[model samples]
Target: MKFEKESCSVKELVDDLYLAHQLLVPTHLRFSKEAEGDLFIYTDKKRLSQVITNFLTNACKFTNSGYIKLGFKHLRGTDEAAIFVEDSGIGLSEEEQEKVFSRFFKQDEFSQGAGLGLSICQGIVQNLGGRIALSSKLGKGSRFSVVLPVYKGG
Candidate 1:
């Protein structure tokens, strides 16, 4: 896949996504986002959106009744931007976390997917010169983040 990397406003993307996925959020779960100001990133906007979409989708599926949050965090002097999806859901064990990004690995055998969503997300982030990270604990929750270089455009 070809990526048309460009400068995109992180805030705007989050706003659009929040609106677009409103219907997908389960009635028993709470959904929210945290995007402050006009954070910018130099990357393929569509690809980034795809990664976040997968994160949110998985979070909702595993979480029976909890909160899912999408947030963008940029440290004042850091060179990276972190766009993340966090959830209070059925988290992963150390073993599952190690293989979560592998091509066809799924923690839940009955889950309705080919288990490619996270693998694809990893590929997309790598192609965009970023890294995808996950933090989770069994029966607690999880946070998936895509960290990329910040856009320094004037």
Candidate 2:
């Protein structure tokens, strides 16, 4: 891992991710326009891209009709910020959510992944001084949030 954090344009990062996977979703599916103005964050672009793409790819795989949103926001009254992956797909139960990030944990054995994406995401976020969170309800959908501190002075 490069593990380098430097001043970088968030817009560039977002655009890259969008271009990389936008076509993978079924032609009829559309990404939500949830991204806002560009904001800089000191971070490793590669790892962050990996994390975001992992979330997006998983969401797209499970979602067939509704939208998937990827966006960033600064927590109100705080320097903390987050990148979120929200999807309208089969949601998980509390018991399932507990092991969502565990190695080899798979929601469905027949799903395409090797069960390493979320576990890797958690590690990457933790190394970046952030944490990955999930909020979901069975039969509704899931939202995965990766929270981190904004750079004070990179």
State which candidate has the highest TM-score: 1
Question: What does candidate 1's lDDT look like per residue over 28-103, in tens digits?
Answer: 8999998866688989999899989999999999998789998888856888888889999999999999999999
**Lowest summed-lDDT stretch of 10 residues in model 2?**
32-41
Candidate 2 regions off by >4 Å? Answer: none
For candidate 2, write residues 21-107 as lDDT tens digits: 777767766786466666677788888888988999888887777888777777779777777889888889999999999998999
C-alpha local distance difference test of each model: 0.90, 0.81
Per-candidate TM-score against the hidden true structure: 0.95, 0.91
Clashing pairs in 2: none
* C-alpha RMSD in Å of predicted model 2 compared with the true structure: 1.5
For every candidate structure, what is the RMSD over all alpha carbons to the true structure, in angstroms?
Answer: 1.2, 1.5
